[model samples]
Target: MAIAPQWEAALQAVQSPPAQRRPGRPRATGHPTDRYEAKRKAILDAAARLFTLRGYEATSVRDISREAGISQATLYHYTGSKPEILAAIHNLMADELLPRMNGILQSDLSPERKLAEYMRAEMELIERHPTYTAAMRHKRWLLPGAAQEMREKRDEADRILDAILQEGIDKGVFHPFNVKFARLAIMGMSNYIGTWFSPVGPSTIPEIADGFARILLQGLLSASPHR
Candidate 1:
């Protein structure tokens, strides 16, 4: 049977072993700004991996330290607590994702194209950061105080999408629908990509992006009664 073009490569990447985990130490003073940023990114990456694989309640500071190759004290130095680490993980995701989403909002593309671009971008982002995806999967059920700020940031993200969808309606590019429901449906489709998408599989990122765009556009585009 022919494989679906949407998820093949993502599936493969998920199954493969991740690269070496990041260590827990701060960068040497001499390192470039980008290098310092890279190390911080690595720590967050490792924290996401551990927090996702093991529930927030079950995963300990030591586990994150071990996965990140740093001392627990060092982890504390970077981020005060495991809860704080979770916050940082979600913040990292928001930092990268929201701006790209904002860019899409401002583009003059057709509404359907914009929607498609958003979905495709969302998938690519999740695939690149599966650990964040995992944590997000359980976001509502997260331990108290662990995800509050992240949730706030995510709400802001949703507002951006809501505005775009509203624009599509105002412009007659989409059938009028409740903005909240529309936003949920769009996000549901893309956010779930992390649960299944793999980078090593047959489907390339562009392919998956294109496929998702088609599906979303088909649903959202204003239809012509005449075929």
Candidate 2:
């Protein structure tokens, strides 16, 4: 996740703003909280687009400010630095997906069905939030202290998947294998959708999800002793 040197320099510059401001600043007319949130969302939306379309390192704070229709100073008021903007984007994805995923994990469906549903749910999330998912997948290294928290969230998801795999093995529904490796394999396949999937592509999200579930749950090899 090492950000490009240029982006690293931009981050450093944004982090260290001038200590003084000119006198006679104009006062706000609207409620501070509402105005603040609106501006924050605008910055995040703009940053997500830039970070996804252009690499995080290549996208400057000025670029984000222009895209957001706010001055660089105003952007700083909402987000302290470029890294904070990136972190907020990651947080947005986590806030949207984690609770739903927890619910999926707690569902009473059999492990096999649960896994398929989980895969479908993830695919749907990616389809709905392509920018956010792309940022999560690609710019994770830009998050400094927050990277550990993100990893913890990922580990939590992994544990849920591991539980499903173990339950399947316990019930003799899924053939035994290394559960950890299996979880990684399944996750690797699903997480990669953001890189190449398109809404207008040949197949829909559900079609891809179904295909992925079938491949993961049912082997490609014929009925054999290994299976």
TM-score, one value per model: 0.77, 0.76
> How do the residues 1-227 of candidate 1 rate in per-residue lDDT, one tens digit apiece?
12234444533344434345465754567657776567566667676665665666677888777766767786787776866777777777788888898899898876666777777777878767666766655565445765666777788889888888888888877777788987888788777666556567689766887787777667776775111
Report RMSD (Å) for each prediction in the order shown.
5.6, 7.9
lDDT of each: 0.70, 0.73
Off by over 4 Å in 1: 1-36, 138-146, 224-227
TM-score of 1: 0.77
lDDT of 2 by residue, 139-220 (tens): 5556668887777877888887898888777777777788999988989888877666766668977788778878887852
Residue 4 C-alpha lDDT in model 2 = 33
Candidate 1 structure lDDT: 0.70
Per-residue lDDT value at 222 in model 2: 27
